[model samples]
Target chain A: MMELDENKKFSKILVPIDGSESSFKAAQFAIAIAHKFKSQIICLHVIVSPQPHEYANLSGLVTPKQIDKIIFDVKKETNLWFDRIKEHQNSENNKIEILTDVILTGLTPYGEITQYAENKKINLIVIGTKGKTKLKKLLLGSTASGVITYAHCPVLVVK
Target chain B: MKEFKKILTPIDGSEHSLSAASYALELAIKFLSEIHIISILPSKIKYGDSSGYFGMVPPKYFDKYKKEAEMWFEQLKNTIKSNEFNLDKIITEVITSPLSVSSAILEYGESKNVDLIVMGTKGKTGLRRLLIGSTAQEIVTYAHCPVMVVR
Candidate 1:
């Protein structure tokens, strides 16, 4: 007596890609879910380095304009990635609109993910855990833990 | 598009769990997937009268918890019944585990080969994470399949 309601839908889905294998797997799952719901997918790429220039010796040499341009370029690169993904999804009957974002803030990956989910009213967040930043011998990354703890919406974590 | 076939949902009879069940049911209805409701009872009973006594819990000690959890599922069934979804393929399971709840969930889910996991989390404050680790975090750490943690 089960029914698959074609009317049931997801408005917005978020996936944070860190170029990790698990993150790409999460993107695959997110795209599938978004396709079923006929919703939009937002692929987020957070620059791990907030102060990229500070890491470099040219602290005073690079102006804020240069930094902004750098951020824009990163955003463009992210856009291209999402665009390719969207292109691949076109073969499927369900068309999923993809929006790409490159966040250059100092907030941790989890913090940025949760904040974006909240601000965008995302119905679901699909994230991947690389387990690289885990503290103990066996555990999730601290950032994934934080997002799972703090996000107001539902989170789908794929490892 | 990848559609879910089997969804594992753990319920604790808490508001958070109820919210999670609601969301998971929505997805299940959309996917026409079977919903498996799993409730884990603590090996040691920690009810109102027992201050901090830790001992072997009798079978009867878990009956009440099981019933309460069943009631929660009944409510969920009603919610689903009223909705357009004519689905009634619900599987209920209860386990008394000495291991942590998250560990039990991962073990059970693995045994069943569930495709997806949808559950709730009452996350502790930053300070509490330093002391008592969260079950949601542990499940996310170890679950082989995707886990949907609902607020």
Candidate 2:
């Protein structure tokens, strides 16, 4: 008979939310995993510049307020994402304690996300990919690909 | 490079571990490989003196270990016996102390030359895991073979 250890459980899971449908799906999957292991969820959102510095400089009238508005929109979307998570948890009768939402503002999305996971000692990262085609992904540099390459923790990229 | 032909899973009797085991079984079926399950006894047991009376030691500790092991083995055996899928082969091993869990697992994988290592994560964070980092993370970073960590 194969003997197994019985006391193991997942205590934490890091989830990155982008307010997209794919990210929401990833959150659903993360919630299910958390319920199964009675693990805590770290919901993170990285606020990134939609345009690069070179591009921003070219578009002269865009003020800091515009950037703040973008950040505010992302935060509002993240809160909506959490609201959906709460609804799912209540419906499923899950008892796992999820940590409060985390919002990180940075220029590099992948770097900030990876650094947060490492700093927080996150064991698993659940992320959603837009699932761009090979050429498109190469040209655009998808966040998921960057995370898979740089993240030290195990990453589950939900399509 | 050749695809993973044989895989070893170290089960810790937790639901998380069983989920990992189930995932391994599914992969084996897909890849036409074999699965080997292993359980390790902690190193503390080997260094401690056994001069005390048997009754003096906590019987529950022994019983818990035995019962958990039996349960996991039974699950694996039944899954194989049912023939629900083409698993190719299955094996199990239980090792008592004298080695740390991580080292034992690494040694077993190295000796067997398995293509992959699959295990469950404990998902610990912060100062709590400062000294003892996650086994899954360590294995993924250091293992010669690719590791698939199931949450």
Candidate 3:
């Protein structure tokens, strides 16, 4: 392994994305931090597939063709989201490099985030506290908390 | 004007804690700030119960902790001195609490009027954290200054 130089600052910053307003705000923060530290921003968006018994937006009688169409639509939506981010970056004159990943995972968003951060050797993680689901918080059982508790790197939970 | 002037960094001497300290030292170089390295002594037993001895730790354990704390601070001080981060001032301290260590850390930061806090997210065991609660989250929740958490 090559030795790490002492002067490096935030070599890799990870942001778990959900394409929500809060998550976008977190990306904004990540951008600013990256500019200061000369780091790369890793934007991660986890996609959750519905279970067999779980409710699908379409009717239960949906065909395989319909499922394929849904997948295509989802990928397109995610691409558009990143395109908007590129537009924002250009408008803000921010030169920070951003890498976006749309992942398919189980329902545990926080667990996936923590694992990804560690596996990627992420220096820092910036994330929004509340997710798409507005479920009641279990005291400190928020997604941000879960990532903060278990993450190998430091986690910034934007409120 | 540079926003961060005095930075407070709390550590548990874990691998990640040292990394966070180095990051804080880098910030200190940026702003010509003072870095305060502190280690909080946790209360081993669970708190908030009337049945248990409240606000008091066993004297024998306290004495043992006091010596260990001094050694930890000395080690931290030596590390800071050896580091070539262009940092002019570094102060190391150890805070002891029988309960509510997180709140105590925050209160200490407030008292010192530190502009920012840098800490590691991983150090204490998950089970221990579950019993006493997450300190980093508590500090983030209560701190008036901006907190930069390092892994």
Candidate 4:
């Protein structure tokens, strides 16, 4: 409807994805914005490493090898999500660059996401209202709220 | 591209809200969007209560706030005009409602089929250094369409 301007641009947009349909929707929205602005999109997924205490019950059964396997599986799954989004991008013939990052950390997902945005100097963040832990009763997910609270740049929350 | 056909931006004449307004204008210029700039005043009169509480609020209270909203709209318009952008499709309204500020904005946005809501991270009553204002938080939580919180 309008022409792009040099001053009003979202050069870099971050889309934090969890393995949820809502997050995929967010990614789609980000893709659309990227297509419009000719901006770069970074899809980040943070894997919250299970606390050591949680493994107390399965101390005998769970080993470091098992934890590695679990992390590997999670990484694989996260990659699939990236691929799915890439497929959508390709389907639309959108050539905007999409970069995917997976972070394994003990910190909360929101904390990590905000930190990454700050580190990357992200201009905008497009996130879902709810994440993998749907919590239908709560209108917004804790991670989404937390990110909104701490992010330094503008946040576009996709429903 | 997903075009934002209509964008709703609620302002309270605060510095943060002004910044959000400028951001919304930028986006609207880029998307050729019809901008709706609304100022919402929380009704001074309390509803669903006794007649005593209902009559406590002065009759001019709402009128006074409505006039204030008009001033804000004028100031915003001047600033936009100074920037030399086309304001042909821009709409400005003052909403006086018994509902909370965030609720009123959301209701109007939904009724208008607003494609995106761009608002400030804080309002006039927001505390400095606070993570986020309650009104912005509530809007982001409840709005059906995409909401952009400008800082």
Task: Report iRMS values in order.
Answer: 5.7, 10.6, 5.8, 5.5
True contacts kept of 2: 0.04
Candidates in order, TM-scores: namely 0.82, 0.47, 0.68, 0.86
Q: State the displacement of the C-alpha of residue A156, model 3, in Å, after optimal TM-score superposition.
A: 2.9
Compose the digit string of candidate 2's lDDT tens values, residues B83-140: 5555337777766545556777888888999877777664223244332236664565
- Residue A15 CA error for candidate 3 (Å)? 0.5
DockQ of each: 0.40, 0.05, 0.27, 0.44
For model 4, residues A1-159, the per-residue Cα lDDT tens digits are 122236557889999988799999888888878887789999999888776676534554556676777678888889899999999889786488999988776689999999999999898999999988878898888899998999999999988
**Overall lDDT per candidate, in order of appearance:** 0.74, 0.65, 0.70, 0.84
Sort by lDDT, top down from the best: 4, 1, 3, 2
Candidate 1 docking category? acceptable
Model 1: per-residue Cα lDDT over A1-159, one tens digit each: 123234334678888876666677788888888765678888888875446556444554656676687788777767766766677678787676888888776687788888888999887888877634534454466767777777877788886
Docking class of 3: acceptable
Which pairs clash (backbone N, Cα, C closer than 3 Å) in model 1?
none
lDDT (0-100) at residue A113 of candidate 2?
A: 85
The TM-score ranking, best first, is 4, 1, 3, 2
Better of 2 and 3 by lDDT: 3
The parts of candidate 1 lying over 4 Å away from their true place are A1-9, A48-62, A72-80, A131-139, B45-56, B82-88, B123-133
Residue pairs with backbone atoms closer than 3 Å in model 2 (clashes):
A2-B73, A4-B12, A4-B13, A5-B12, A5-B13, A5-B14, A6-B13
| Model 2 accuracy (lDDT, Cα) | 0.65
Position B44, candidate 3: lDDT: 65
Show pairs that collide, candidate 4: none
Candidate 1 TM-score, true structure as reference:
0.82
